[model samples]
Target: MSTLPAYVVFGEALTDFIRQSDGRWAAQPGGACWNVACVGVRLGVAAGYAGSVSNDLFGDALYMLAAEAGLDMRFTQRFDAPPLLAMVPSTQPPEYFFIGEGSADLRFDPDRLPVGWRSAAQILHFGCISLAREPLASKLVEVALAAHLAGKRIAFDPNWRNLMTHAAYRDTFHVMAGITDYLKVSDEDLQHLFPGINQREAIAHLRALAPFAQIMVTRGAAGMSLFCDGIEYTQPAFPVTVADTVGCGDAAMGGWMASLLRQPDAAPATHLRFAAATAALVATRTGAYAPCWEEVSSLLAQQITESPHAQ
Candidate 1:
């Protein structure tokens, strides 16, 4: 069997401090792009991560984790600064407080892109806080536009956080959306981006902005909907025990990307089943934990048996 095509994931890898019930804090390796890349590698895809990190211990841990996850670390750059940290309150839904100013992740320069990286990757996936920031945001847009012109697929998950309602970040959001080939957003994201607009209207509005892009809107627990090739697909979220929702969506994105890479002509139902199952499995785990290939394969097989359209 031929090896699957590789994917290049661009963005940050930082530690998240989640407030515990015991009046303490626990730190875990996170960053959406990092989780997605790790999950991709676990699912048997050759994945590469491109970004910068601080010389601190937390950053070193992220580097080691990426290496252990089988991701190519050749494009990663390091600096003497401390890694960015996010403080998650116990009551709210994953709120982040970026600690470092001009952190290493934002120091990426387009000229430093690894040799032949752009041409070698089948898909370039990026998103989350990286798209809402300054120097990094501009750099990412440059890289994405270059990749698109080179004929590589661009997968974007706005992963729009509620904190990005500011004027500057909102403008960058639209700019990034314009260059995407595949986009994933949540129902909350739709309303946040376009206040007072109905779901259908938001879809139409986004479609008009990126006419050539295929869009997927995830409605937590309820289901997810995908608009592609002049058609729409709505699939229910898999029923499973919830632990923490941190990496669930990233797992789904990895599954969808993996399926598309393997079977580019697969039906919408196939994509949804694979994505929803992977997401469900991830939700049962803690903090950005990625599922192995065996786990995803089992889920896919079970889904096929349970869903008549999962062929």
Candidate 2:
């Protein structure tokens, strides 16, 4: 068995402060890239999240969670700065703002990562507000380019957040899109990234920007569509009694990327179904829940057996 990670995600790892209906705050270790790395590792891929976090209690919780979930911890770094945080004042409208100015996540130092990690990483995933912030954003972009030049697969999800301005994120998006092998975006993300444009035009814009990338556009509850090799494969969302969708996008991205790496020759529908099942399972749990390989496979198996097309 190799010690190398098949999937390496770069971005911020922060604590999410969700306000409860009772006027209290609850803290959860969450970040888009962290969630993706956790999901991938949980789903049986050798994965790691490369970033910096504060050497405080918040960062301690994130570090412990990553270790518990089997993430390659060599890629994690701790800084003596303030911990990054996502303050969520409301959940109904999905309102959030980050508090990480000069914080630890922004101080990510790639040079500190384990030596030879660049070459050992088979697929490098990048996205979220990490790409929209300064210092960290520029560093991550260079890292992505280095990974691309090394002939490694690139998986990106803009995972657009409210903090991103179209001007800043648009430039980063174009740069990453050009090198991305697998790109995931939500309909909501497209709305924010390409506002003043309709959904069709938005996707068209993405296709034009990332001509060779397999773009996965997810429409919650309505399902997802894949634009691959100039063909479109649409699949309905895997239904599950709803819980929290916070981790669905990460689960979907992790699932699809894992499928692609595991079975490079699998059909698009097969990949989409696997990804959707993984995400659906996450939606049935609270927080950024990561499903193991057995759980994802079991859900997929049950769905297949229930499908009308089952032979």
Candidate 3:
């Protein structure tokens, strides 16, 4: 049998220091790109990650987790710096305070990208702080643009963290949007990128920016919306007990990409349903934990069985 197409995720690999309700902290290996890669590999896609991975304890933990999850680490850039750290409060809308100045993620050198890495994967996913921070931001854009020119599918998620200015992120958004084939963004991201505008206007703004890309927007509990082939498909969020929404958006992105890899010609609604279901399952757990294929399949099956359309 032919080997499955590989998916390459390029961005940050860092540790998040999540503050617990008991005034304690727990370290979790997470970065938006890393989480997306984890979700893809966990969902049965052959995936690899390319980013600056430090040689510190947190970095070691991130590497082990990725390796255990079966992610390809051949493209990861090893650095002597420490891993980036984010202090996240346990709240409904999680807030972040970054403690990474000269962290490995920020110091990523795009020129050192693995030879033939661009053609090694069918799809290249990029986003998060790697596109929001300096030096690396430009480097990542250069890499993404190069990959696009090489005819590889490009996926992007604006993520829109608090660490970067709205203007900075907006600028990066435009740059990536031009080359992105698939765009996964959040309602909050739209609000930050195009503030004082209604949902219609916000979407219009995105359309104007990336008219060719299939755009997916996650709207918290309301669910998700997709703009593809000049048509709009909306899916309501799956009802699940919320633990925290820290990784819900990334999970949605991962699920959408996984579906694309498994079923490239699936309908927009079908993709939206799968992605929304994946996000709902992820929201049931804390942190950016990647759900296995069985977990997502079980939830999707239950949804189909419970839906009135099925009857």
Which candidate should be chosen as best, given lDDT against the real structure? 2
RMSD to truth, every model: 2.8, 2.3, 2.8
Candidate 2: tens digits of C-alpha lDDT, residues 1-311: 24768789899899999999999999999999999999999988898889988898999999999999999999999989999999999988889998987999999989988878877778999999899989999999999988888898899999988778757777888999999999999999999888899999999999999987999999989988888887787878886899878889999999998888788798887888888888999999988999998998888877743321211
Candidate closest to the true structure, highest TM-score: 2
Error of 2 at 192 (Å): 1.2
Better of 2 and 3 by TM-score: 2
lDDT of 3 at 91: 58
Candidate 2: regions farther than 4 A off: 304-311
Query: Cα deviation of 134 in candidate 1 (Å)?
Result: 1.5
TM-score per model over all chains:
0.92, 0.96, 0.93
C-alpha lDDT values of all predictions: 0.80, 0.88, 0.83
For model 1, residues 1-311, the per-residue Cα lDDT tens digits are 12333698888788888888897999988888888988888887888778888888888888999889888777677877768887877535555577758787888766775667776789899898887777788888888888888888899988777558788887777776887888888888788888898988998999988788888878879878778788887787777788878788888888888778777798877777777778888988877778886897786666534442321
> Model 3 off-target regions past 4 Å?
1-5, 166-168, 305-311
lDDT of 1 at 261: 75
Tens-place lDDT digits, model 3, residues 1-311:
13433798989888888777789988888988899999999999988888877897888898899889988767677789867888878554667777778888877766675566666689989988888778788888888888888899999998887756757766788889988899988888888878799878999989889977999988999877888888777777888899878788889999999988888887777777888888999999977879998899899887643321110
What's the CA RMSD of model 1 in angstroms?
Answer: 2.8
